[model samples]
Target chain A: MRRVLVIEDDPKDMAITRNAVLRAGLFPDCVATGEEALSYLLRNDCAYILVEPCVKGLNLPLILSLANKRDRKAAIVVITKDSSLTSERKLREMGILYYMVKPADDMELSMVLQNGKAD
Target chain B: MEKPISILLVDDEADFRAIISDHLEEKGYQVFSVGSGQEAISAAQEQDFDVALLDVKMPGMDGVNLLQMLKEIDPSVEVIMLTGHATIETAVQSIKLGALDYLSKPVRLSELEVTIARALEVRHLRRQAFQLRERLRQKEAFPEIIGKSRKILAIQQQIEQVAQTDATVLIEGESGSGKELVAKAIHRRSKRGDGPFIVLNCGALQESLLENELFGHEKGAFTGASTEKRGLVEVADGGTLFVDEVAEMSLACQTRFLRILEAGDYRRLGSTKDLKVDLRIIAATNKKLAERAKQGQFREDLFYRLNVFRIVVPPLRERKEDIPILIGHFLANSEVGPKPPPPVSPEALESLMDYSWPGNVREVANVVERTLIVSQGLPIRPQHLNLTSREVPLVTCGEKDLLPLEQVERDHIQKVLAAVSGNKRRAARILGISLRNLYRKLEHYGLANSEPLKTAL
Candidate 1:
């Protein structure tokens, strides 16, 4: 019954992500854009935040700034369509633990479910 | 077939290798003899040797060099240096490089044998220490008993005090009040900390099975005993044996247990060979053992014997101050997952603190897990706990509800069957009785004929 935040642009990708979250026994709160995701964070607390880096107008800095607040902080995981090493390094530097390329498997999702505990 | 204690004799001279391996083999050893250091290293890779005899003067690699490489290959193997040129400096260097001892090449056979025996003994102790260290490095499967309340502090003091002696300890507490945890603390602090800690739930097994589990059986001792078996008593030699629900121990099993307590000797179920084991007994029960003894339900003498050091663990409701700390611990340790943040809302915390924990710490833990799973990453509200089940659930009927022995047995079997959804195997395991006994019970109750065997989840 734990809640997870899913930020995805495509409906199909969002559906897959929501199903995986539900299968992990968590409620997924999906938003298509970073703006909506940030507003959702303003009202609700999540255990994990799943973000797609390639989403349109996905403001990483603003998302990070909002999530950096102590009470609202959640473990951020990057599921990106881009497999650039530079992007992965940037995500790692920003303290995202797992960076899954496009088509992330269930095992990867299960690992995120098991290991995600924001400090 | 598994080979016996093995020795590797490495030397430049083939004659020395042949002589040593033959002599060792004659003395009941599995010997692997090689000419040079390289061969020795490769041979070592294939199998482990208990002891190694190295000649200091080798053609390609010297004995000291081989000793270092061998140490890397299998750190457990003990090495002894054999040299015709015995310089004090070289001997010291060999010892420094991890040789067990250095001996001159003109060593006597008896002296060589004695050195090998000493090496084996040292190797055995080291191996035991290695295994103990590995086990110590891992956390115990059960959670540590956590509390800083006065009652828990007194219990901790009692554990420390009683741990100094090997006296029988009787821990009295409500179910899930952490009797087993207290027992573990005692054993860990006792002189027998390094030895095994064996636990048995007396309530989970029948009289005959309980006796067999504790005392073991010799092959052909009973119809299906098959091979000789070592029981918990033997396994707990020089350790601690914790008997939970000791009040549930049947009179017949109690009599057998009494003999072991008094004489410190027991025969395997089917054999007459007297076996002796040194162990500390720690018995625990949720029932009033003295009252049971007064009612003739438990043996008076056994009760007195186990009451040498009595420690009562208070129920969780009595020590409400510990509830918050316990909740935090359970949240952090939900599973093999990451430590979850303790995000219980104030109202939820107040509700938890106010509730009467009839099932004590165990019930609180279950609630913590269930609520955490439901709440996910959000702050847990009061409603998330779903605490409608207010009363302590009974595993068996209360004393007032006791039926005839036959009816009680039938009812218990029926309950177990229903729990497993008619799966006989799992029910047998839960009942601590064999499948044969279950079938017999079923027939006696006339249920086997009425209800056919069905596979169930």
Candidate 2:
């Protein structure tokens, strides 16, 4: 079973994503802030990572550093409130595998996760 | 048909003055009797006395001199001159010196009350007229546009120039930058000022819905089409049609919109009747349309047609000089109360200027409103702003940085876990990894039995 991690500060948002993953028949871990996220990854062998746009203290730079390390193939998905091509392109350039705008229904999340497996 | 009025009596002849004052007071009138002209002046100055009766034959300052002085003290005080001996010249002089009326021999109480009542009516009318004039002056000082910044002035000038022409205008700026305000300004100053001005946000609706919204739908056009409806374009005929976020329109919608622009004609949904609309088009967008056009996400021809007259509204950060003016504009127009919060502190203003307002003018307005509501009457401080200061940390990774992914992940997770007091679930969430993955990794890193890991779970 491929493991998934959700990095988000909002508790309600975290629960929603967790339930959505569970509905998709997957168990995922959740954290409150960016600092804790980096530490979790250091001791984990995660198959996939989900990040929100407002993850404090953990930004694109830190994510890039983690990606550049040995297992650079791990897929990362970024969630943002804004749905713009420019933002998507920027995330792509930063080595994020996928980008999804929030208030994303369960179907959209499931689709992204399925796409991740294929990739 | 008349009511008795109150009068203040002033005279050195206490017997005569008291007798007449009692006569008037008995006629349902309130009379305040004073001994001398000096006493009368002091009494009138303290209270709002409607009328004053002065004896024309007083010892020191007779009626005429006292009348002139009393008129200066209280312009509204009606003075009735009471003279036991009357002469035409003295009566004329008393009347000229501002006495309301002169009486001969013993003063008639009825006549005195009538004169005082009329004077009070005149005073009331004068006050009402003065109040009306002041209100009109206030309205003219503050006209519609709120900001006093030079940027706003420049934008106003641009609107004046563009409004006169029939050219299509494209307004580009970040979200909440008051693009609609600029559009309204153009329509207000345009030749079609009397005609209607309609707005449609392209990104807000689906392609089919947007089409129906822009072009009227025929009865039975679709499932929910219960009645015939005129679209925004037909309603906006002989006026301006402002399309907000035009870049968000679908490619197909763009083709049809472009054709309508080129031909100045459109057809209703489920109908073949061609409708001609004499309307001006004004479009706004936050996205870079040119870049989107190059990427084939937006139509190039449509972009050109809309970009004939371009107005780029600078973001809030670019126009930091306008912040104070904008704040003042909001403050003056604020309907808070008779008294508002103390002026925004310089430190707070400087912090606001330094912030990179991704939300633009609308965001600033929201922040100002929030600050006013939260701070009550206190001065707005930096902490009240609710803005996050962004700071970027500099880090260098070398060739030796080719550390194992697992090791890197472990080091980062350990640091974060330590920072968060060994909370595994929180640590995993922050790393964007699942709890199961975190546990598996803990086992892989040979830290599965660690006390911190146990405590965290």
Candidate 3:
């Protein structure tokens, strides 16, 4: 599998997501800010792009839009601290595969990665 | 890079207009305030505005009447109706008249801003969608293949043989040799020519994202999915999906792609429902697939499935005979309006022909465009040519290599296109080329501005 790209500003959240990927037997390349994520995506392919809702010096919407633009096929899973209806709707329109609230368990994350679709 | 969005405010109430205009201008909008519907109509006729705020009950002309006139002038300008009386009938009527949103009077500034923002967004999307549809419609006419060399003739013959069949074809070519153009030609000549011809760059996105694009997700399918979205497979139901750079797909994505090819059955990212599609897939790659398959870099089964029918797009170096003809085609096909391209000196032509086109026809196109820009309206001189430093032109020293026959009839059409910002109809009229011909060249050179990257997917 192509490695996942984790875009989380919060070190704790980034650690949790990175650990979850490792436990699932997948390697991931983590970026701390949206700028790093954008540069990374331009040159590297991401199996799944896990993005944070907000990051320092980076507009969340523009990042997601650029991500969506650069890679239309990648499943974009948003890791958001605030999943208000408005933000959810906005990010959804940005064409993300899903948005999970912060502090999600490793098991749930792994399950979503594998066999989340009932069909 | 983004120009400020301009707004036209029309309200009969002077005090209301003054207060709202002041606040909006403070927010950094280029606000143009007028007191009545008549003034709004005249102002709209005078200048292009992004959005128009019209009061429902205006003195001289009602908002509804003015709305029709404004739309007649420019249907793209977004209009928001403001009313003091809360009548459901008027609201419905305003909407029917193509009002973006209806706002009650005594409108809070914050709410007004939100409405205005939404209106602007709608305008932007509508413009994007319109441009997309126009390009697709224009893309229907395929360009004349500009090569008469044996390799190109063979490829053209192969295209003729396979165009009518609904088969999976893998086009192999070097980058920039017009692999995508060949795909479009195949689609144009196919039975599905009338249907949507969608394209995806397989190498551009990762495996997981590619899956979402091919198979859509449902509402609440993931955290951010608020509504059910359709995928490219569904969109390409009756047409063709041209997946470019198929060799760039990861092994996992290749497996998924093969499954789709095998069964035409797939599920969206999160949905439980299985979607079956009926369409032909045309995939292209510059890589030698068989070699890659042997090296275990590509799956043998997927390669076999994709290689059922193959078209090798010969590189430009193999067809040096076509260079002059190709130059003529490019010169005639310049995006420059009515003005014909300046004549090319024989020496300049020799330099262009001698330079190895590492970037293939795409590079040739760029050189032609850049040379045209540098040459201005003068005959193309040897110095006007911009080639890589490595390819020293075989220039005849000391002689001003001039063409005995000055084919300077070309008026250098760039100015008309610049005047119109590449609007094809006006360009066609000035250049005397058919609208379809202009579109074909523009599409070939990738000059059309608002190409629908997400749409027709």
| Cα RMSD (angstroms) for every candidate in the order listed | 29.6, 21.6, 19.7
Can you rank all candidates by DockQ, best first?
A: 3, 2, 1
Q: For model 2, how does the per-residue alpha-carbon lDDT over B1-457 read when each residue is reduced to its tens digit?
A: 5644557888888788778777777776778888877787788788766778788887777778888888888776777788888999989998888876787766565676676667667656766787787876565333444455677777777888898999999999889778887888788778987877777777655566567667867766765454555676876778888898899888978887997789998888889888888999999999999999999999999999999999988777777787787777676556552265568888788778777878777666667767777677688888777765532334678888678887887777777777677788898998899999998888888777764522343
TM-score of each: 0.47, 0.46, 0.46
lDDT of 3 by residue, B1-457 (tens): 7878889999888899999989999998989999987888889989999998988898779888999999999999999999898699988988998999999988989999999999988998999999999997775433646687999888888888888998899999998898888887888899998877776666644566566656766767777565555566766777888888888878877777787899998788787777788888999998999999999999999999989899998888889998988888888888742267788898887787778898899878778877887888799878988687548656675546554332222223344566566566997898788999877756654555542222121
Off by over 4 Å in 1: A1-119, B1-143, B336-342, B390-457
lDDT of each: 0.81, 0.74, 0.77
lDDT, residue B7, model 3: 92
Segments of candidate 3 deviating more than 4 angstroms: A1-119, B1-144, B392-457
Model 1, B1-457: lDDT tens digits are 7669889999989887888888889999988888999999999999888999999998999998999999999888999999999999999998888889988978788999999999999998998998898786564422366888888878878888998898999999999999988998899888998877777777654566567667867766766444555566776678888898999999878887877788778877888778888989999999999999999999999999899999999999899999998988888877622355648899898888878888888888778767877777678898888875534433786788767999888777877777777889999999999999889989889878564434344
Of 1 and 2, which scores higher on TM-score?
Answer: 1
Candidate 2 segments exceeding 4 Å error: A1-119, B1-150, B336-338, B388-457
What's each prediction's clash count?
Answer: 1, 17, 18
Angstrom error of the Cα, residue B442, model 2: value is: 46
